[model samples]
Target: MHGKLTPGLDFLSDGGEMGALMRAHDWSTSPLGLPERWPQSLRTVVSLMLTSKFPMFIAWGPELAFLYNDGYRPIFGAKHPHALGLPFRQVWSEIWADIEPLVKKALAGEATYHEDLHLVMERNGYPEDTWYTFSYSPVRDETGGIAGMFCACTETTQEVRSRAALKEEQDRLRELFKQAPSFMAMLSGRDHVFELVNDAYLQLVGHRRDIIGKPVREALPEVEGQGFFELLDRVYATGEPFTGSSVRVGLQRKPGSPVEERVVDLVYQPVTDREGNVRGIFAEGYDVTERVQAEKSLRESEARFRNLADHAPVMVWVTEPDAICTYLSRSWYEFTGQTPETGLGFGWLGAVHPDDRAWSAEVFRDANAKREPFRLEYRLRRADGTYRWAIDAAAPRFGSDGSFLGFVGSVLDIGDRKEVEERLRESEAAFRTVTNATPALVWVSSNDGNIVYLNERWYEFTGQRMDEAVGSGWTAAIHPDDLGRILPYWQRCRETGEIYEGEARYRRHDGEYCWHAFRAVPQTGSDGTIERWFGICVDINERKRWEEHQRLLINELNHRVKNTLAIVQAMAAQSLRQVGDGSRPELQAFQDRLFALARAHDVLTRENWEGAELREIIHEVVEPYLRQSTRHFEIEGPRLRLIPRTALAIAMAIHELATNAAKYGALSVPSGCVVIAWTLVPDATPRLVLRWQEQNGPPVAPPTRRGFGTRLIERSLAQDLGGEVRLTYDLAGVVCVMDVPLSDEGGMLEHQSSH
Candidate 1:
């Protein structure tokens, strides 16, 4: 039936009619398996599916028959009917330029495929770039011949742009790894073989090329026996990461040669799957050989220093720059009787002697502030409650940056030496006082003969100030005429340490010369070293003049005594000659005896009357009588110095005996000999006894007369010298024995005479 329509309805009626015709065609082709009817819902479903959120499209062969999809409407917005049933190249020429090749390949029975394709297409008259992954497949007829191309595809512009950005990020990561300084590697698989290694890793292993896909041990063979492979095995087995500080690794360039070992700080990181199972490991490390060695050397040096401090004899201590002690050696405890803990810090200051504390503190403060070495003497209190002198020396310690770190010091005991020095000073002062108080001029000179010290008497004698006479100044006061001799003598005294005495003229205060007796003796130390000279001088002018006068008096006395004795001898001889008038031989013998006494006295006086040798005295008295040249005499006694009176008396007594012998007794013939010997008897009161014997002469008889020879022999020595004299006329010979008292010979005689 024909239907009438309004103008607005006609427009909707035309679309409805077209829809009905499509449904009618589908219903009629139902047996041919065509769609039964184009339902209103079916049209709406197709439209919604094409315009879904994702970009979607449908194409047949090289043509776009319908473009209900929202993705395609933009490409043919204003050109509708012209775009329908047109080749895709004719509707969107720019997009079809690339899409046409993919469509032809699909139509030629190629399998469907998609790729990232960039298309510049006009969208509402604006050119736009669109990326897509459009796929095409063959639309076959019932007979299986290629009929047309069917396509179902989506635009992939956002995904393509995102993938490009990800690639850029990966490339940047690769660049960073290439330029890295440290060795870096990626390890995978159960064996922990390297999957990838950077250039730095290759260089570190000294490998010229890549070491990818090789086991760690095979690639870095140098690390086989060094336990690195074992470490890697452990990490793989445990699936744990490890970080090491200063690990040692040995690497060798040649087999059997010394390895190039290095110290490194390293980290091993475990790469895990999403399930947290470790699948690989990553290694990162740096060579730290130099730093490790330096630190080790520093530790060794510090240990050596500690050992020295522990064993030192002196008290070694360390303190902060603030003067607070930090460490004290073992010696500190031994010397101070305090433990290390008690001696540290300012505790040590408490042990200082009160008298020295203030000064020591001041010195320490100044040295600390100035950062200077400190040396000072102080007294430290000992365990015995006495303060001992100590020398404390310290030097500042500085850090590497030149900042003052602290101080190291030592303390040494010097109390004994200090006491000795003090005693020496006191002794020197006492010596000075004694020398000044003496009446004689005294001075002490240096080893070089320069006057170093002098008594007050020296200044008084020379009239020079102490400063003026010190050193060589004393030479100025020496008399010019005596200087030549005195200076040489002074030099000899200094060089040889000999006692020196010399008479020299010295210049007095008024510039007049005076005769002074100078005497000097070198003062020596215990080592026989001459330290200085002690000298004394006295004025000897008066004593010298008196000695000269006494010489003349002595000469005159000797001459007078000799002349008187000679006259006495002459008178005695005359008397003897007179008594020889033919009848009294005994009287003549008495006169001869008197002459012998005078002659013996003359011999004793010539020997200074002190004493005479016994043998000499006997020879002189007996020579006239014996006349025998070989008369043997033996005299044995302690060496004796006898008084003058005893010697003279003994001489006279011997002379009388010898005279008797020559005249009528033992010595009348040449065959006779006399032997005289003397000895001293040692006792509280010693006595000298002499024996005289004669032999080979005529038989002797007692004389009847009291002759002068017998009287002189017995009386003079016994009475004058306080001794006994005996005369014997024995048958064998004439024997004379005399005993003289050693101690009061003359004194006893004088006492006896006074009584």
Candidate 2:
């Protein structure tokens, strides 16, 4: 198949490099056999194609064996070497359908030509988009019958792509221009020939589509004397931009229609080349005739007496320069039961109540003469024959030239507002009367922190004059040391709108300083803004002295009680000693119980005997247990402050429970623990639920006998608290629950309770 240059391939000689390749090519497996077996016509065509520089190929015989010249070698790409003698369809299978018909026509003796034909070809191992201009001609065999096709082609991909890109960019720009909102046009050369016009330009020019490609002068003949032509010429000649605002122009926009005058804001900008030479003028503008005409209509109608309102919310009226009524709104007619006949001119004056007519007329006349705005309240007769209050207000209207036209006025129904005003005055008067009669000093302060009013009691207390007692001046009577704390506290309360309360000393008229309780509450408006502060100062000097005396008496009583308990403890000790050593342990227990009572009383005294926190009382009785090496007690509950009597009873009960626990219960073992928790049960009469649960303790049974300590815990404690007490002896541990009465007003009480 691959021998030295085959001497039999004489026809392939002197035909370029493809001829040499053909001579050395294998012919044993080829359907065409070899170049020597090829028909004379095919040989001649191949030879001619091989010597030519143009791309050329030949398909010969029934196999239509493919062959190509050296000039077309690059088109074969990776298909060379084995492609020379392959079947044409196999060689170009990717584009076979497209070229098969042409191949058939050529073989049937018909020649064909295609210019810039598009194709997708698989060459060089990948498919590529390409274009070609080619011709297919039939070639005759030795019998003078068409047997094969020959083709000559040239790739035109670059040229086609360049043309396509240019068209795409042009289309995009044209679309942008057509969609522009402003009228735009391009005129070329000195004559200003129309080159392009967008849709907006056509709309502005009455939709004349035939203007493109025509000279501006011929296209818009109606704009001959409108100065547009002159402006366009000047811009084109001098290469300068021309801008005009509200320029007047006349146009015969439609055929057989009269000329319509229009106003426009226009700009003529010169279009230039890269050389900076002007080539054309671009025109852009907007039509503003509607705005101009609207302004003109407004001035004309309002120059003298205008219908300023017809459907206003309130009654409206207009007057001429001479104070003659000209017009009234529909509201006025409906309200006053008058129409054009009775409401126009001075007839409207009849609607005013008889009692107010003279003064109302004089007020209107004086204001109209002075060209002033005035508001006045007067009684006006309604359609139902009722005279209702109304607020009449009017302002002078001037024309564009500053000439006074008339007064445009409105009347609003103030009947409701007048009633409210009367009620407010009565309320204010009542407030003053009550304050004056009150036994304490009262003051009113504006939201700005300035005291605006003070009752007579304040002057009586401080002996200051009315002017001195009101406003910031009243601070003069305040104890000098108290002002520093009061001012900042008052300021903070003013800022946060919180109620303010404090005890401050004020100098009485007798030159004595007395403690006074000062309380101020904010008066808030509907919108949640504080409008003012109302305050009172009550004398508390007597209460203060009484409380001090009570405290001193309680201290003295406590000291005496402690002394008596010590005396009794000593007496019992001495009696037990006399009775012998048998009662010694009982005497020790008695002393411990006394100490527990003393601790509870100590807690109460710290709070001035007012109350004691339940937590504080529990800790006091458990102080001995808390010092142990291990934690044998766990107590938790909400914070609660108990009255003195309740504190004493609860402390005694807890102390007894702890003593029993240490001797025979949870505290007897290292693993044993006591968990005590309490909670409030809210009910008609709220109750405190206290639970003492012992865990991991020695087994328990009912006690053989009840001791005095147990009796005290079960009976006396429950009676003192006005509740129930239960103690259980389960096999596992000891449990105690005490339900005690709490104060009824639990909500107002915080964590502290009056139990």
Candidate 1 structure quality by residue, lDDT tens digits, 153-272: 666778988888999999999988877878799999878788888776776666664468888878777687777877777787888888999898887644456779778889888888
Candidate 1's displacement at residue 12, Å, is 99
What overall lDDT goes with each candidate model?
0.70, 0.86
Q: Give the TM-score of candidate 2.
A: 0.55
Candidate 2 structure lDDT: 0.86
- The TM-score that candidate 1 achieves is 0.40
Question: Which segments of candidate 1 are over 4 A away from where they belong?
Answer: 1-377, 381-388, 391-424, 441-548, 570-636, 661-674, 695-706, 730-732, 745-755
> How much RMSD separates candidate 2 from the native structure?
21.7
For residues 224-318, could you state the per-residue lDDT of candidate 2 as single tens digits?
A: 87778888888878999999998898877777689888888889999999999999999998777876886788778655333446656799888
Residue 246 local lDDT, model 1: 89
Candidate 1, residue 38: lDDT: 29
